[model samples]
Target: MLAIIGGSGLAKLPVLEVTHRQVVRTPYGDPSCALTFGHLGQQNVVFIARHGHGHSLAPHEINYRANIWALHNQGVKGILSIGSVGGIRADMGPGTLVVPDNIIDYSWGRKHTFFDGPERPVVHVDFSNPYDDGLRSRVIAAVDAAGKQAVSQGIYACTQGPRLETAAEILRLERDGADIVGMTGMPEACLAREMNLPYAHLCLVVNWAAGKGGSATVDFDPATAEAGMNDVTAVLQAMLS
Candidate 1:
């Protein structure tokens, strides 16, 4: 089965026909909340909110290890993670939907790996490509099928958060070849990799990055976020099916 991890503007899947909710406990800890099992256009799927249901957890505080473990234990083969991002590339701005091809992690202080404890063997997983290529192709096809113009690939910059990045930090990220910036993409992506589960990121451009476009002041318009989510949800549902 497939799994969906919702972040920020998306806490629940409107397209899912709810069947039940399951509470799971992993060796790491409890997941963010109960996992919802349901159908999206004839496909059975599970979903969990990356942040808590009330949007109470910050990116830095998320239990990504537990979340990934819970889904993996449940036999989920692939995961689609959705979150809001700040646009860094010229063509990616508000209301844009993108499936990132690569990522640069600048986040710290979060539990990053499943092989940290003593009982586990010193396992080193290859991470030359963070996002799964096959799953990304499915997403790109779904975007086109849903009639939305979604960018096929870009570089995601994951930063330590609870706080937004400084203009200088964003500039550094751009220099590092980042095309989008957000807080929640690091350990979550890595944890999924450790689980041997294929994962893909579907990002919504909520605003411009700190040093780019309209983010000099504040331009995270709610209307744009809502509209973008509405458009992408259709594609996501199609992808699941």
Candidate 2:
């Protein structure tokens, strides 16, 4: 089964056919909420809101371990993570959907591994090529089948944030070769790797990064971000279908 982890604007998948919700308990703790089971076009997909359903959890506060473990326990083989991002590269403007090929993690102080305790043996997963290639291809194919114009790939910068980045931080990230900026891509992707789950991401460009485009002098506009998310929602529905 495929698991879809919704972030930011997506709290629930309205298109998912009603089935049942299961609250899973893991050694780490509870997941953001219950795991939602449903079908999309004959395919059974599990949906979980990375933030709580009410959008109460921050990026740093999300239980990455519990979320991955719950999905793994529930027999999920692949994961499609939906996230909202700020475009750092000029061509990736608002409303663009990108399948990230690489990621630069600047997040800190989060539970990053499943090998921390003495009870569990020390384990290490390869960091190179973080996202699964075959899964990424499927996502790209899904977008093409949906007839949505999506950027095939880009480098995602994962920052530690409940707050957005400053102009200087955005510049630094750009210098680091990031095409987009987001808050919740860190341990989530890495944890999935540790669990050996095939994972891919569909990044919705909600706004321009600080110091870029029209957002250079002002804060990100929520209205614009919401509109972009609404467009991506349609693409998501088609992808699932």
Candidate 3:
């Protein structure tokens, strides 16, 4: 079964055929929201809002362990995560869609690994290629099948934030070879790996990164970001179908 984890601009999927919501209890605690079972394009799929149903939790505050554990316990085999991002690459402007192949984590003070407790035992998982290659290919194929143009691969910079990045910070990320920037990509991707779930992400470029394009001199416009994400929603619907 496939699980869809929705981020900002997508708290709910209107296309999902309503089934039921299950509140899962995990060792780590509660997930952001209940596991939503439903169908997409007649295929059995589960949906969960990475934030709460009311969009209350911030990226840094999300309980990644519980979220992944709940879905895995429900027998979800593949995960498709949708997130909003800012373009760091010059060509990846607003309204662009991308499937990231790599990620750089600058986040700190978060429970990044499942092997932290004394009784848990230390275990290591090879993360040479952070994302599942086959799943990433499938998503790229889905995008093509939907006739939507998307950047086949890019490097995502995962930042620690309940706040937006500064122009200098974005520039530093660019220098570090990041193509896009966002919060909430780190432990989520890592935890999915630990769970052995096939995972991939669909990133929506909502705006230009700070110090790039026209955003160099001013703050990002929320209205423009929402408009760009609306286009992303259309593409996602088509791809899922």
Candidate 4:
């Protein structure tokens, strides 16, 4: 089965045909919410809203370890994480969908690894390529099948946040070659790697990054996010079909 981790603006999947809900327990702690077991067309999927169902959890406050462990324990073979991001590149703007090929993590103060503490031996997982290649390709194909255009590859900058980035910080990320910026992309991607789960991230650009696109302030519109998620739903449905 495939696992889907829904980030900001995707508290619930639009295409899911709900089968049941499960509150999975893990050694780490509770996941963000109950796992929704459902069918997207004929495909079986398990989903978790990264933030709480009401969108109360901040990026740093999310229990990444527990969330990952819950899905891993449920025997999901692959994971697809969907997030809302700000456009840093000229081509990335509101409503644009992206399948990021790589990522840069600026996030901190979260439980990033399972390989910690006195009993566990330190293990180094190769992160030379952060995203799973095959899954990325499949998402790209799904976008095509969904009749939606997506930036095939880009660098995602994961920032620490309850607050959005400062103008200077956005500038720094752009200099670091980040094409998009978002809050919840880090440990989630790496933790999936540690579990050897094939994982891919799909992003929706909801606004221009701070100080970009001639906007003095970052303006976010819920309507834009809703529209972008509609596109994400189409791709996921196509992926399942």
Worst 10 residues of 1 by lDDT: 210-219
Evaluation by lDDT, superior candidate among 1 and 3: 1
Residue range 1-241, candidate 2, lDDT tens digits? 8999999888988778969999999999999999999887778989999999899999999999999999999999989999999998988987888999999999999999988877888888997998999999888887777777788889999999988888899999999999999999999999999999999989988888888875632645778767666666666666667
Give the clashing pairs for model 4: none
Whole-model lDDT for model 3 versus the true structure?
0.86
Best by lDDT: 4
| Candidate 4 residue lDDT tens string, 1-241 | 9999999889998679999999999999999999999999889999999998899899999999999999999999999999999999999988899999999999988899999999999999999899999999999999999999999999999999878888899999999999999999999999999999999999999989988864524477788889899999999999998
| Model 4: lowest-lDDT 10 consecutive positions | 213-222
Per-residue error for 207 in candidate 1, Å, reads: 0.6
Which scores higher on lDDT, 1 or 4? 4
Clash count list over all predictions: 0, 0, 0, 0
Q: Which of the predicted structures, 3 or 4, would earn the higher TM-score when compared with the native?
A: 4
**CA deviation > 4 Å runs, candidate 1:** none
Model 3 misses residue 75 by how many Å? 0.3
What lDDT is reached at residue 18 by model 3? 73
Query: What's the lDDT for all of these models?
Result: 0.91, 0.88, 0.86, 0.93
Error of 3 at 30 (Å): 0.6
